[model samples]
Target: MKTLKFKPLVLALSVGMYTVVETSTNASPIVGAELRIVLSEQYRSMIEEDVEEDVEEDVEDDVEDDVEDDVEDDVEDDVEDDIPMDTQDNLVDAFEDQIIMSLDELLEDSDGESTYSDDWLVLADDEQLNALEQQGYSIISTEALKGLGSNLVKLKAPSSFNISKDNPSLALIDSIADVNHVYQLAGRFEPPNGTSFHYNQLLPALSSQQLRLGMIDTSISLEHETLSGANIKLHNVAKEQYSQVKDHGTAVASIMIGQKDGFTGLLPTAQLWSASVFFEHKQQAKITTAEYLVKAIDWMIAENVDVVNMSLAGPPNAVLEQTVQKACDNNLIIVAAAGNQGPNSKPLYPAAYECVLAVTATDQKHKVYRRAARGDHIDIAAFGVNLLHANAT
Candidate 1:
């Protein structure tokens, strides 16, 4: 077997390439910029059209029933009563699909790998999935169908890599490689020349752990002195649409695990899991789609991770909620941002889930972030407002 190395987010299952999609958003002031209206419109059309089709189908069914019952005292006149019920069911169905699709689209992309031709792929085992996800690969939509008259599972495009057949040694490499270990990244610890109090407080603990960090935003620098002591892992889950320059993940990681010299993170012992899952540099994509997130969480659980931090949010999602719940049940401390879409205080997933620890950011002024989501879902608050960290500097 030829020696080949696997990237952080895209695993090398075979001599192939992959096209991944992920969620992306802008920084504090640019949050709205990340919400691509056109993308949303396409998605909304896809959804509304589906609902309309369902309503028409339901109406026809109602018509048939009414005709059958007409002899029993004008049952046709009672269709109004069923209208409301039909509408409610349709609405619920639409909402569910929207949630699912939003997550899927955010995690997938229109771009594919240069060497391979497949448009999609999925990891089968928990171990493989986690290896991909922590580096920021989330599933959008996938088909795992039972074969004709057989119990065997057949995955759709980008079938799970056949490590044994395609590149068996790659699998062996992952099993033996320590890249998954945080300490391996070389430039992760050194902070920028001009550091802040936050970085000063956090850097040492991370260095002592020998762990590296990965950030998915543009604010942090891969060459910064502080991060120099650590490794700088980057990913473009959104393809060329995004800059691969933003450092939202970097800033957030710095807050949670950034080294000293100036800024400090919550858990200094943890290393960075740097990945950029966005496109067009400023569009909203699901950084870690629900499917990939499940795998990522599982990986963290298996590794017995000390903490998993997420500084992003979106509407409530069932699969995501369940995954976080399972992670917590397994004793992994999951942390998430309270979402910058707040002030109106709608609920956000992971952060709002019962098992997660939701944190809201506060600025230097000690005031809550204007967009930080609020409501009963918010469990705790952190100094997120205009806060400086090693990644930001």
Candidate 2:
């Protein structure tokens, strides 16, 4: 059996890669050294769509029947009592007007089809179905947007419909009156750099104690050596099989609580509930969608997790924002990577959200990692440069 070694570089609070350092004859590797980290005290904060078609049908039928019966009674009475011809015409016109007004009101109260772009996840009421269907949109799936206590529907556009740059989906979705919000489905984020394998000396085991932690990332290798004694609960919300590579999620998990033989993690006793939202693709980099991420957060909330560690980053999404806010309101702390988009890159979320604690990477000397995102949103820095991590395989 071959044993893999990793060196501790830096700890990325939000998101950044750490490198593994080779050991020298005279200097001891920092893997076993007690890290003196400054903990920041601050940093914390915090749609129903349905249309009842059966009820609408019932109302329509009742209204029509009442109108017809009233008109017939009025006509019969007018004929039998010798009412004037002009009075009879006026009565019929009034009845017709009343029927038209009633129908209009009923139609207004009912949901119509809502229009949206292909890239949007629309939250629309059931009454908007007619308008949406007219615009070539249909519900493909539905999931609970946890904390909001409402279900978010995933909609798809017609196969022939095209969203050109000149007519972006965002603008089209915004024009829709029924849509509460149209959120862009984010693609999977690539893992941090410097993930090559290395050999190192094993560090002594640390004491195990229990802590509630949540992780939203790729599938983890539960049987990995480093995770031998870790209390981990795995949920596959990504709807895909666990990947054999399993590098990203496994490494992140091991860093959180894996322990075997002489190797240890930051929290050997952590009760980790991992929600797998990312999956490895054949030709593309591992990625996740906004829908899966929302589901993962919902699962975390249900588990009553204390802190959530998100080592992934992507564009700002309304659905994600709502979910994060709900998590904070429930007193669950959210820690996200500031992303590896580099110092000049725009801030990524949920790190950018006001309620979340954004973490950047730092080196042994406490210098910021060159690739780590820099912005006012960053709340703290952690070691993530040249850090030794457990191998997934």
Candidate 3:
């Protein structure tokens, strides 16, 4: 299997990486520390060309060997000052070993690697609730998951614990990972509310050409020029923050319903019920949680959207799978991104789920996109390259 391996620690004398993010293949994420920063040969060539004068003394010592002695001062110094931005590893390595980085900062990057958290979610009930008390675990959060004709508790574990097969970074080997609720459905299952989603009578009658679709992505810009006067209703499903949205949703919404001269969306007259689940992270791009996704899907179901678009890629979750199946049982059609992790990467969900149509990216020439994930689940292809579309900004 193709695995991402970590290098040895740089080992500064005074400080060390207080937290570590370990990279493993098909196992839960582990925290690691003291990332090593290798001084490539280019360090010498660059200094030889750019050095006008040293701060106090010449950088005459070999970049690697002699500098090892003064690593505390030379290496411990904010790394960006000594090294060029283009050459450094990812954001994690550009710091002193002693620095206690926040989870967001440490996870800000990997080496051309999209960063991920090792956090895992477990299904528990009041009797099985292994939810760590705020006093013990690193962090804890809970959500109500409606699945399999019963209510289950979704518990979020800290980075130290993780589970699931799709996100190889997590493992269910921990003791807590085993203390999950195991229930068997007794009688023939009926389903949620014992009914399928039907169009709302309150909604205006639609023409034959009009369709009902749902957008489960970032927030949409209803006022964007392309989307003006379009039948798009946005529901912010974030639990806390009331006003948090981004541009990705706007771009996607434009592609679905926006109609202007020389440009037209696939369903220009479609009635879109958009559920904005993503919120602006403290530092990262807009981020959403599995809970948000479940809530969004539930909202879409209530809205009676015939089809929904999930433009996201990530590890699979049991609750999410259950909710998706529920949606499928309601006769809702789910479409998802085929993922950009390359052909060799593992399948991402909900695209990988049997209930969804995994939509892969192609170009005007019908060639598969260079990074579009290839898998048996990919049921369709769409134009993914080089076209003028609406921008949020």
Candidate 4:
């Protein structure tokens, strides 16, 4: 009798019950701290209004209809004719007073409410940043995300600034002219997970074919038995740490390109580009931020992979959304897990992005996984319960 040695099968797990607890009690603005600001369209609207006023004043009431027709004609001829340079300059000159009045009115209405936080993601432009700096906010950093063309500027408030008494940033919104949107950028995505199963039957290997596949997950073990012979590339984007676990990424990579120990992946010869984005958080939960995910996507885009797999889920982020949209526009296919947020949980992204193909899980019985998130965004279902995978030694 021949004895066959079987390696232990490990499951790719998900973050089941990890929650971030807010540590700050006081809503004080931290000077020299970074905050992202989105440029608003309101400033452009105000400029358009000034242009309209100028037109109305120059034209007589009797010929107003004729003049309006000519203006519309001019708009059709050249869109830029709507808000010329002189009108824009006038708006910029008046912006300070407008923002001051707006902020004062908001403060008056608040009646000493504390709705501001020390950390914020603001939507503003260079001109707006100047106005904000004049009002005591400090510019920390600025990044113009490629392809999306959105300029995100990080700013800091004065050291003594306390929004608990007054929220000046709210008023600064008016002067910044192009402030688009503001959001608090503290959220995390759950890690991928699965169950382990053993199969005694060995499947025959299919003919190998070349494929370009990308995966964004944890680190992968390069010496794993199943992945040793596969063409796999790694890009480390997470923080370096000791005792790092590569089981999850290794299993995922195996499922995509492994062909060892009698188990074969869908594309055994596919070239894998793996991006490590998850890291240890508090020694328990695996956490990844939106910034890291965006950077991974950017890397994948640069590599021009055919299809990218995101076996993780998190809240919607503007930067991530723009990056995904740009990827789709470039004809890259994005395959994402629909998430393990439970049946009643809200939809997750980039799975929710229109350009992505959101995949959910099911068992051999064709029943949906209990923890699988369900929604109209889910594009397909796959067998994900108790699947066998190569164990990292």
Candidate 5:
């Protein structure tokens, strides 16, 4: 088994799923670049039309006001139109198949990963969904986002642009459909460089025995040598049919509480409630969802955990927003990955949420991680470039 080590935000997992765990001695740091958006030839042709239209409009607008607002507005509008967001547009179907994830070449500094779904999710009860399904609408999946009531329903429908023309009744379902968006791990593995903030200085100044830290990520390895004697308790919030990965979750947990001769956690003796939400779906590439997030956070709050660390990011959803706010209402401190999508990418949530403290990755020299997302949402930077990752045999 070859073990690899990386900082909290990103985890390297096989496409097929759960990876074996071991301490990696020769883990190579892979420098992460912003995800380049490489449009397929056909997709490019379609985008070209829209791009030209936007350019022409910009030219006209610039002619009218070549000053402050024009430049700022164009830059902002161009970004919003380019990056993958809510997919209720003419390009909805194309976005699902047209987008692919690769490094800089195809990377447009996108949301890190170009993931989107065509399913339309809305606030509806089971009876309401059943009525729609009976009337010929396609009901795909459904989930009850705990405190949000049993109102979330996933529907397979046409894009919003065609909804009124093709499925007129769907218009009455909701005003704005929350397209089922997917999120990915927030960081990448890179060669060890730059110095990280040492916990040694703060260790003596604080009482760690009582700090209860809750982590929401993949499954963890209790047997990891670094975690020997650690006070860690884990639970699986993922559905029974799904499988969980441990590499990313263990790395984060080790950082939170693992204790060893050389590697000591932030709070070595602190109690931890490790909630694993990363689960592999049979039909979808996503390992988790907004619903899973709500469940995990609710579990943490029930356990009365003081602080929560989320090493992942994705598209924002209302259920997730409500749950996160609930945590804040409980007076819990939340810190999450600021995202490694690059300097130009949009802020990823729950890190982008106002109540959460967004932390980005940095190298030993304190330089920003090459792929770290930048925006007003970012609150702090930490040493994330240098890490000892794992590879399981």
Candidate 6:
């Protein structure tokens, strides 16, 4: 008999059990001590070269598109032939690890053990939950429980339904808003500097193409003024890590979707599919677990999403690699933030994998982010410093 070895899986609490608390408390985000964004002449020269290359590539594509259009006019067009042209591939490495290091420096004096606290109120079917509870799993709260059918539950710690070593039951909730009564924390970031993105640049393009983006991040504010009128989809993979929403993920999402007449994202018409792998409290130090990220990949695969934009990184893990590979196999475009750790090519899991697209940060002037990672693995670069995002509402 042959034995197959499986990697150990970490179980996260999915259900929230709130204990009659009056108000809410969330952990503060970690901020860096100094805000530094400088690109040397050598780096500037590199950016110029890259920009030239990009222009050349665009010209080539335009010529190819013209030729293909002429061909299609004569014969039926094959969609598969056009697919690769629009697909996002060959991105450069954009690491702003300096930002993370600065954040850690700012929190140097603070204790790293603090946890974010928030609430997730879920309205569920009572009979179904009761059936689940009867199976030795405790029932936390039910939504719309008043009409004898639906109930609401306020959750605090992470809870689960059916989790085991052999079979892990992955739950797919329809929409983020459906999981009502969730208090999210906000992360403060110094928007990347250099080119100020405007809606005109990205929104009109996306709207014309009817495209949406899946932002797998920590949190988002549905009521934020900048995020007004944009289609957003939220999912809480962190389950109990609602507090982190305020400080981190919300800021990232805002950068991607925040509505400023003058400021826009790379994909403004892009609707966000928000998911969190780390809690707000965990930002004081590096996150040790990769399960939440893995689950996010699994969710994307299941949903057959167009693009998965994640701005988080950590030490590489085999499970993380496998999940990224699977996502690639599913034809999902996975874009990840290069580790902020600067010039270290040791390899950062999903970003390091051939299946994923590694994006490094550049300045508004298109200068390379000082701490951006580099190597043969790097594919493309983008602005990550002094950029603008949604303010706390």
Count of residue pairs whose backbone atoms collide, per candidate = 68, 39, 14, 22, 27, 53
lDDT of 3 by residue, 207-290 (tens): 334778787877777767778879988888875433466455665665566666545555567788888877655544456666
Summing lDDT over every window of 10 consecutive residues in candidate 3, give the lowest-scoring window.
9-18
lDDT of 2 by residue, 28-144 (tens): 110001112111111000000111233344456556766655555555565547867667555554554454334321111112211111234544344444445556655656655
Candidate 6, residues 38-86: lDDT per residue as tens digits?
3233443554455545545646655676664455443323433453642
Between prediction 3 and prediction 6, which has the larger TM-score? 3
State each model's CA lDDT, in order: 0.39, 0.54, 0.50, 0.54, 0.57, 0.43
Mark the regions of model 1 whose C-alpha exceeds 4 Å error after superposition: 1-221, 231-245, 260-269, 281-288, 364-366, 390-393
Q: Could you say which candidate leads in lDDT?
A: 5
- Give the Å error, residue 16, model 5: 25
Q: Candidate 5 has what TM-score?
A: 0.58
| Predicted candidate 5 versus true structure: per-residue lDDT over 16-69, tens digit per residue | 011112335332100012223333345645664665566567576445544544
Q: Native-vs-model 6 lDDT?
A: 0.43
Q: Residue by residue across 1-393, what tens digits does model 1's lDDT show?
A: 111121211110000000011111122210001111223345545655665555556566556655434433333235435568668455554665566444533321122101111112332344544454453433444333111111111122223322223233324324211100000010112222222234223222333444333232333455554455554444333344224434444445444454544343444554555444432312232233333344455555555454555544544433345556666666556655556655796666556677666666544355665555567766554443223543333
The whole-model C-alpha lDDT of candidate 2 against the native structure comes to 0.54
Better of 1 and 5 by lDDT: 5
Q: Give the C-alpha lDDT of model 3.
A: 0.50
